[model samples]
Target chain A: MTVTSSVPGAVPPPSTEVGPRIEPRIALSIRDLTKRYGSVAAIDRLSLDIASGEFLSLLGPSGSGKSTILMAIAGFVDPDGGDILLDGQPVGGLPPEKRGFGVVFQGYALFPHMTVRGNIAYPLKLRGIRGAELDRRVERAIDLVHLQAFAARMPRQLSGGQQQRVALARALVFDPAVVLLDEPLSALDKKLRAELQFELKSLHQRLGTTFVNVTHDQEEAMTMSDRIVILRDGRVQQTGTPDALYNTPATRFVADFLGRANFLDGVAGSVSGGCLTIDIDGASVRHRLRDGEPRMGRTALLALRPERLSVLAPDAAVGDRNRVEGRVVTSAFVGSQHIHVVETPLGVLEAHTPAFGAGVLRKPGEAVALAWPWDGGVLVEDR
Target chain B: MAKRPLSGEPYVGFLLPATLLVCGLFLIPIGQLVALSFGGLEAPTLRWYEQVAATDSIHRILLTTFRIVGLTTVIAVVLGYAVAYAMAHMGERQRLALLLCVLVPFWLSVLVRALAWLILLRNNGIVNEALLGSGLIAAPLPLVRNELGVVIGMVHYLVPYAVFPIFATMRGLDGRLMMAARSVGASPFRTFTDVYLPLTLPALFGAGLLVFVFGLGFFVTPAILGGGRVVMLSEYVSISVLQTLRWGLAAALSVVLLVATLALIAIVSRVTGVRRMLGAS
Candidate 1:
């Protein structure tokens, strides 16, 4: 099934006069929603707008309220106080079935008594689609998930990955306006999760339907989401494009959560034209601000990525940018790269450098200089 | 795996008593029952079988027994499912309170409970008194000495047994399955029918069968509540053996009742997995 939107009386005049309208419509809008179970808040005041046909991932650790947000939007858990709008209309009081959203739970939750065909045909049966058309849609759905050979098999008879596919096909069979997946790939192995991640991304593209996925794995969010919202303790840490979150984090929590980050605490000495001069161990270092640069005399935490640092020669006058003198305490070869732990005055800093064809490796106690460019550092608030 | 040798002899000593009990006491009685059904000192004959089949009142009594059992089973199952569903979703204290309420009726002696129902449903009982005092009825209703009282007492006895199995099954079921169904465009009622009801079918069948079999052997409620008007199979058998001194006819009727109970149990087991349903209950 294909989804094509044709706005009446809004046609293009000519090829030169037409510009692209690439952004999809907003399918679900959540505004200031909060839900509490007992004394602990499961979902704090969180607002998010999911665009139509866009695959959005709510990535966090356990108890970070990713699943709570999904449940709130699905109308399973009523928020203590806020509203959820679907397609510009309020639907806070509606039940989950009235929300018209398909959900694939963590374990797939396929009816064990139903065959593959019967499981896929359940939603259609509920909508009163019977006889020939029902059979046709069921067959099409089974084919869509590539489960033609297992159509008559029970859910338990299929492998974990196969059950997950059947769940996806069943969720999409009835043409739901949006699909919410709750840790759908968690039960599968690593290779299967990676494979299904691409399949889910492509399925979103093929169906042109909005998708909201919840997962604790950050890499899965980075690999699949059009936009990623990282949550912690029932509050959203940050929400942005994957690259934006990776390069520029607003808080130390967001920086440490999304990827590996080495935080350096120092006093912001001065600020000049988007650059902060910080005094580190009696040496002045000017670091360029990626975003949210701290003010003068304020305590600042700088996030430096492991891949951005390099081991330089001790006596080499490197003009690249900020540099620190340290000794390589330990190093390990990791196939494609060598992960080195350099003992510096700041602390033990991790540096990853590509292993180029039998090159000279740094041993323990070898004197070296750790250098990273100014643009590689991000100034984050002390959170 | 091979058995590991312990520092003591294999448990031949523990098995001696149970084995001797089964072979002597249990087997002897059953063998005697079988022989007595065929014949006793008057030589082998079908006289008892003929006597049991000849009486038209015996046939009517047997029919009444089955009808009361079947009706009680149906009513218990429906009400038990409702109560069990409510219990499954209730808070811990509420669930405990409901469970206590269910057990109170079951814990009371069947005779005592039946007497209580008689007191409540009699012509000048609390129910009729209340209605008459309120000017709702001109005359008292025929409630205690009829089929309705028999069913009411039997269901009150059997509902706790029915509810425990069904509630156990419902509690073990994954609540997420219902949520999954609802999120897939199913209404609350549809989710119940397509998901919750199907998952709980085994418990329903098992509980229904248990109540039905227990109903078949019912004696106290019907004997007291039927007031000698609606005679059931157990009461009739008692009269044939105890009052009329007809051992042959009683033996024949007892054999028929045993066979019918066994046959019903076998059919129930086949449909709803008898061994699993009745295990340790």
Candidate 2:
């Protein structure tokens, strides 16, 4: 996406948001994007290609550079070294207004002075879209968010969810080629956040424009994104589909961040065929390695999901392979499942056992065997 | 207006002292002045009002006052907006320096400021001397003892009053709104005109009203700088009360000035809500 000099009058292609569903293409490309504040780097050498008509989320914790990347793409952050491309045209050094993007901010950023109808019509008005055409498009955008009833009301009079909808309508009313959302639902309460997430996802589906969202909420990213890019310390840790990242995380950070993970830090004992055995304290646990994975002999790490571990009776004969004995630290029924905290020789681990009809949960201090299938957890980078 | 006083009716007693103070110190004198403007308790007359409407000198004075105050308010608000914008966007040290520059002038006594302006703006003053020395002008120019001098002095004095309210509103504005405006395809100029300007308008209107109202009561700067030739309403009132001993005419003029100020507020409040205008004012 990088080019030598800035392109003067580089008009972005017209948005397909108003037309029939256009074919999905590469909508945005970030190449070696780097932004630093004195000594701290907010985004460091990060590159990502976002596809058109895809809900791509930048998922990371605070200070992990998720929001920074979104801001850079939105032309708010001037990168020290990098280029951003809109449909293969380098858009670096351009002012945000010339970049033609729709942004949904976390605080909603609704104009306190403008009513919902006026707020939605503002972008169109800027473009010289006037009269009945402007009104029609504004009403359509409002209808998209189901906000016709409150169209004339001011932004302050609306609730958080309604204000967020108005913000959404305002952003989409102009029909930009891409929309960048910065934790747009983070300010709302839990139930409202969930409801808005569904509404936002449905809206994205209906309008086939590219959506680049940034959020720290892992569940929000997983539930809404077509592709999730996990970031840590301003570096791309992993990027894949939701299930691909959840089922096969390349690093402990990814596994632990994307969902709950039980890390077994140990030393690699030996490799037999495709399986590598690791010594966890005194007991040994065998892990099946993936193709192209190098043979390991030093300290190794494995991330086992809690739901993958099955709870069994103390002296149950389920074969010792991939099995560990531990004393139950605590066991409780959470309506749908029985959660067991087991203190094993390696470390304390949790196993979410599916609850049967009135299943009796194991008591604390009682011995139990935790077993999993042969291909249970993935080998993650120890860090 | 609530079903019951949410704050409790007993707390209304806390306002008794302030209410008494306002009625005794402010309302009583204003009422007495209003009574004096009309002819006395028994023989009420509109003689002063008729004289005010008839006198050509009084009309000239009132017109001069309006023109000078109006021009000064416009200039002060414009300069105040520029200063507030700069202070809002500046770094800490620069902002502090700008703040001190504004505050230092505010702390100076009005008499001191007026006398100081007179000294600087007089015919053979530093400004005229510098211009003369630079060969920019053939004559020293009538820099003071004129209406322009009065406006210059008044703008310098009233700018600080205009700045603080606008500065407060500017500082409280969320940065994300600007970014949002830019993101929605508004050029920087368009953003300013469409969003930023409209949003700060309440404060701007409030500053204009403050500067205009404050300028109406301006006595020292105009009296000192105008050199008695450029007699504004306040100076006219002073001449009526002191030199001519025309108490009824002075009181009538005062009533007119108060009504004009109130009318300006009413006009602005009618357009923007009273609560909104007052909130920024």
Candidate 3:
């Protein structure tokens, strides 16, 4: 892979260390898109602006309008209202072929009758490119996906991962303005899915083309996308960087969907020293105001990640961190980490601890104190 | 292995009745026919086959049969493909409606269907009377009792056969391939020609072969619609047997027709494997 990087016009190495580079120009903009079948709206009035050369993922479960948004952008589904703009030009009037955006379907959708070279050369041939120039582009695409050896093989003969690579190559061969992928890797096994996820992310970095991916897998979205748009019930629940969405989710659905979150329901008592104290049953818990300021005497929910809570010994010195006493309900060893479910006064809180030798293992029915920093718990609004 | 009693018999015992019925009903009759074509009991001579080859009328009859069958096959396939494509893309209820429409003719007897066409297509028939009344033509056109009538009747009868295989293949086709093609910048027309047409080629060939082979030996529709003006191979064979009592010539002609059909199937199966041609996938 490194050897080809020096070749002219070849893809450069994927920048693994740096974060997503935010470009100045917007490549595509979707405004007030709406699509309905019968009485159910598949895509409600949703709007989003995609930056150039950014890897954006629409992350959600099935029927969450993620795939609908991708299809609307690719011009496969006609929106009832609103417009889609490509480089500041309205493209809703154009057909899918004229829109000039490539898409990789869920099943790869490779031509079963055509060879790999023929499949990759299809779009170029449609544009009247022929002979030497066509061959050059096809060869370059084959090399881009590292499938030169399988250029003569049919789609059915290739493995699932290889077929996905061919699909990726074919989508890129036409030099489309943006590529839309609709769950392209969901067909593979877990190990191959992880491998292709890394390759897809690196491929985006090297090519620097705008990519729009729709997937239900939160981990995949977090690992590959520069920005994630969390959708639910045909509406945009939240949109932000992976870190922001994971760390400070704006809603209960966003917090629960992104990771394992333990919710603590309480009534806001009073505000003191930039912190809001909430009364859970009779115990008072303090949390920093991150998402929004809580109103006095109003109910609120706090999202605490399992990994954020640590089990502390009874004799441990308590500092500024919020502490709670609970009885261990059950604990399980999961190779690198141990998950303990504890019954607390507020609710059953789950804590994840590293299986390192530094901590003593807690047994079932044993009482333990759980502690977390004041800023660790995020305030989220109930849906 | 459970070591059942029938397992060691290689399953031939289960096939006994069917095998005996087929041999008695089909194979023995064919063997006797072939033997009769060689001048039965006369030391096996080629005089009957020679007589058939030497007859000028036989050449003309073969030509007419080929022309009619070829035209009917092509017409049925083209029309059937359009109907099948429509059905494949329709909603479930609409698709079922179309399927019933296609199957309605199959419920009618072939002779009844041919007689119905004869009533509608003959001179002074409903179609001609309507055309003459509308002043579309100055006189009643020749709509039946000719090659054109034979082709029309034959095509109608063969269309259902042509539709089944192509429709099966179209139903099995992944619609996403067409979407992928469009997404890759190919126009809708190009996507149909490049992706869809190629994928369905095997089934089309199978349907064409089926219609052609069936039309080759067709008897009822051509005899009724042709009104004795067009003498196809099957009708000639019947006349030779029933009218003239020329058993040897009839058997010779029948053998030739059978050989031609089988050879064509063999060649097509070699080109596209039979399973694939039948739209297995």
Candidate 4:
């Protein structure tokens, strides 16, 4: 279910009526942000609006300016151009401390000298909250991260996951309006990272705070984010809901980045009724236009997910359209599914079959027929 | 029995060479001094110890030595922290220029630097000449041949030593931690105090102790700048040994000075790990 939440602390309830009209309920707006090191531009003109209380991830490979965007939001890296607005106020010139953001760095960056309790209590002390109230807030933050038992221990004495929790608790102690995570789970093992990913998502739901995370791991982004912004070469490739980007990727980059896909190069044919036929080499594969259809005679690239393609069983009739035959070159059993590599006339393709289900295993060099529904493919403009 | 070179011999072999060097160079001299302090010139008596401990001149010299050392250390550490902070955040060209500024004075001959200060601080020196030209002063000011002059020269020489260690530590510090602090709603000053300062305390204390100990044995700067007016322990000992040929008294005073400086270093060592403080740049 889609959920909308009132920000826990947008304004102090006194100045909400005097402001200008705002859209997207944007918790953080990075507008035309750019940073350069000498001659190399680290971040080119990038603009994105993050809805309040939503988990938005800036997903990119290394040097794609994902972490730079996160740091700019945290007010650590000053952009050469563009302005960052938090709740509709320009925050470009503001120092990091005045930004009031909570950041979980890649390595956690827990104060090594401080115990878990001391680390969490730091922001409270900075806010001038002390004594019993400070202790209660610290305790609440510690318990929120499920690190109460380890509060008295030094950060070095804790495990990687526990240290990450302490880092989270320390960041959240003062109840910051927004939290920025810079690959906070990249240091953990696979199992621990998976566990913390769930914990972080649940914590975001419980706290109702805007979270901007940066990661190169597409799985982490797809699993935890409300919206994922795919970045490449210091620019935004696409931004949308995970399903939207997955199913209707705006470009070939997004389609390939979000998940694995097979692309079919073709020349666009006529659009009769709602269906459009594309001339793929010598084979004519008909597809239904969902959103943006390619013009006639334009070279278009069709993106089809591997799982959507199915192998037809013997004595079974082929579908009305979008059917092809290929030879299964190799197949391997992978726990719950059998992964098959089919050598098609177009190219080699992959398909996953249920390992436990009633499906005849296709041995190597077996001639097979592959068919996909017309609605299961996306037509991306060749750029 | 022929030993199989001790199973843990490699580790010991690594530590042994350095340990032997330290013992031969440092421990032996201090041990000899301690032995001599308890011995006597005429006979094995406690008379020189009693005289050295009871005399007002030696006591005054000791007080002067500590005062100079303490003041130099405090000022150098504070100024060094500022220089180190500047170095840490400065752009490449600026950082190089500032580092050159800190090191050039340190590398210059101590006597030349002291003489240069004396020339600037004397009655008809450039400082008074400028002040007179600007009409800021009616007469030449008293600067050299006093405690102020000695303090100035000593602090100048010690500041570079202090800055290097603090700067080295600050450079290795993760800047992201400070960014994290600021993100948690701290002001720049508050973040510095709450996060950066505490992280760099070990280096600061270490630099202070190192500068202070070095300041105690200062011989050339005090002799040239003091002009016989401010008699630090080193100058006093020089006078006793060379001018008066009072060997017994000079040895006793030298022993006292050595012990006091070593004691101060030991006290500082207790505050933080000494090996680390000295080992770092």
**Reference contacts preserved by each model:** 0.82, 0.91, 0.91, 0.89
lDDT of 1 by residue, A14-55 (tens): 111011222657788877788989999888776667778878
Q: Global lDDT of each model?
A: 0.82, 0.86, 0.88, 0.81
lDDT for residue A221 in candidate 2, whole number 0-100:
94
Per-residue lDDT of model 3, residues B1-281, tens digit only = 33464556766577878999999999999999999998896699898899888999999999999999999999999999999999999999999999999999988999999999999998889999999999999988898999999999999999999999999999999988999999998898999999999999899999999999999989999899999999999999999999999999999999999899999999998898898897775
Question: Could you give the candidate ranking by lDDT, starting with the highest?
Answer: 3, 2, 1, 4
> Candidates' DockQ values?
0.69, 0.73, 0.84, 0.60
lDDT of 2 by residue, B64-122 (tens): 99999999999999999999999998999999999999999899999999999888989
Residue A263 lDDT, candidate 4, scale 0-100: 87
Model 2 residue runs over 4 Å out of place are A1-25, A272-274, A293-296, A317-321, A330-335, A356-367, B1-20, B39-46, B279-281
Q: Of models 1 and 4, which has the larger DockQ?
A: 1
Per-candidate count of clashing residue pairs (backbone under 3 Å): 0, 0, 0, 0
User: Model 3 chain A: which ten-residue window has the lowest total lDDT?
Assistant: A1-10
Give the poorly placed runs of model 1, Cα more than 4 Å off.
A1-24, A270-277, A280-286, A290-297, A311-343, A353-371, B1-32, B40-55, B239-252, B273-281
Error of 4 at A202 (Å): 1.0
How far is A214's C-alpha from truth in model 1 (Å)? Answer: 1.1
TM-score of every model versus the real structure: 0.86, 0.90, 0.92, 0.86
Better model by lDDT: candidate 1 vs candidate 3:
3
Better of 1 and 2 by lDDT: 2
Q: Give the Å shift of residue B61 in candidate 1.
A: 2.8
Could you tell me the lDDT of residue A84 within candidate 4? 92
